[model samples]
Target chain A: MMKATVYVTIKQGVLDPQGVAVQGALHSMGFEEVSSLRIGKYMELQLDTNDRAEAEQRVKAMCEKLLANTVVEDYRYELEG
Target chain B: MMKATVYVTIKQGVLDPQGVAVQGALHSMGFEEVSSLRIGKYMELQLDTNDRAEAEQRVKAMCEKLLANTVVEDYRYELEG
Candidate 1:
């Protein structure tokens, strides 16, 4: 089986309200040293395949189709056995 | 200087439309081998501080305040020199 880890994030220019809210909460929790924070998503998948080429092809398709939003998000993945 | 890397993702049971769309795209691209895909975000921050405790406090605050949405997102971060 092949395992893949994917990371996704919003584009820099977009506004992130969620990040702002978390920063505020941290400050209230006696963590006043914080400056800024941004949030993203992570995913892990296990595939039943051994071919690297096939894995890449499928992963790339996955990223382009459902793993990432081309309009506001970018995604990358790492594959391992 | 303190550098931190933050990762954020949608909690399980949350709907990820972006992830779903990417999956569809990948399938069309001849990557039918993929079973599932989830998307998330990654962030790298450069801070001007050296104290580990202080850094942690600040980073944690950032995560809680703005880096993540407690309702729908989860976050984690790493600290480095």
Candidate 2:
């Protein structure tokens, strides 16, 4: 089996309210050294096949089709078996 | 300056409703090659300091105290300067 780990992050210019909230919370908790924080989504997929090239293609397609909002987010993935 | 990328994933045996929903959506969209999917959180931190060791320490503390729910999630981070 092959395991794919995908990271989906908001585009640089996009507004991230959840990230802002988390940063505020961190500062309030006395972690004031944090300059900025941006939050996104992480996903892991376990595939039954072991073809690395095919896995990458499928995962990329999956990201574009369902895992991420391409207009506002960008995705990258790592594959391992 | 240093940038940290943190990945927070659901612990094994923990329930992930969001992941389940996404997997179902993928199946509906005909990406049936996916056997299992787990969704988590990804965070990026931009710090004003350039100390690699310090960045790792602070980011780990941040993850433990705020970024991740240790009871149900596990976190790992990579630092780049």
Candidate 3:
């Protein structure tokens, strides 16, 4: 089996209201040391295959087609067996 | 300056409807090699301090207070200066 970990993050130039809100909340909760914050999605996947190359390719396809919106978000994945 | 990366994930045995939905979608999209899936949150935080220990402690507190739901989720973080 192959295990894949994927991270989907907003593009650098994109606005992240959720991150802003969290930063504001942290500041209000007295964590004034926080200067910048960004939130993203992390996913773990278990695959039935053993081939690393195939797993990587399939994972990339999955990220491109279903796991991430390529227009505004960027995705990267790591695969291990 | 310090950077912290945090990951917040649901506890084992918790039903993740969103993950289920994504798995289903992936299967329908022809990625039947997937066996299991879990989804979580990833956050990147920038702290204005240079002290590693202080940054770690504050990041932990931040996770406990707002990032992860103590009752249902688990959180872990890595810090770098």
Candidate 4:
């Protein structure tokens, strides 16, 4: 078996209202030291095969095809057993 | 500085189109043993202070406000140095 972890995040230049809101909440909660907050996504995938080369290729294809929005989001993954 | 990591994911029973698309890509890549795939978001925030209690509160605030879409997405976080 193989395991993979994928991370997806919006591009830095894009506006993130949710992140902003959280920052505001933090500040209101007496956490005035927080400056910047950005939010993104993480995923774990398990494959039934042990072939590392094939697993990597499939994992990349999965990220490009569905795990991430290529226009506004970027994705990277680490694969292991 | 205090660091917080936020993870956002669609709740169970909700449709995950991106995850489905990834499953397709994985199947095409010849690793047919894959069954289920779920995609989500990940974020890391660096607070300007080292106070753990305040930092946790702030981080949680961030998660509730803008780090996640509470209606459809679920969020969890971890704080570290």
Native-to-model Cα distance after best TM-score fit, residue B19 in candidate 4, in Å: 5.8
Docking class of 3: high
Which lDDT tens digits does candidate 4 get at residues A25-52?
A: 7678766777877777778787888889
Strongest candidate by TM-score: 3
TM-score (all chains, Cα) for each model: 0.66, 0.92, 0.98, 0.68
**Maximum-lDDT candidate:** 3
Q: CA shift at A19, candidate 3, in angstroms?
A: 0.4
lDDT on C-alpha atoms for all candidate structures = 0.75, 0.90, 0.94, 0.80
In candidate 2, which residue pairs clash?
none
Residue-level lDDT tens digits of model 1 in A1-81: 798997777788887787677667766876555576666667777677998888877777776876678798877789898
> Candidate 4 has which clashing residue pairs, if any?
A18-B66, A22-B62, A40-B41, A40-B42, A41-B40, A41-B41, A41-B42, A42-B40, A42-B41
In candidate 1 the C-alpha lDDT for residue A26 amounts to 62
Q: Chain A of candidate 1: what's the TM-score?
A: 0.92
How many angstroms is residue B36 displaced in model 2 relative to the true structure, after the best TM-score fit?
A: 1.0
* lDDT at residue A77 of model 1 (Cα atoms): 81
Query: How good is chain A of candidate 4, measured by TM-score?
Result: 0.94
Q: What is the TM-score of chain A alone in each candidate?
A: 0.92, 0.95, 0.97, 0.94
Worst lDDT 10-window in candidate 4 chain B: B58-67
lDDT of 2 by residue, B1-81 (tens): 888899999999999999999989988987787899999999988887878898788888989998899999999999987
Indicate the residue-level lDDT of A23 in model 3. Answer: 98
User: How high is each candidate's interface RMSD, in Å?
Assistant: 3.4, 1.1, 0.4, 2.6
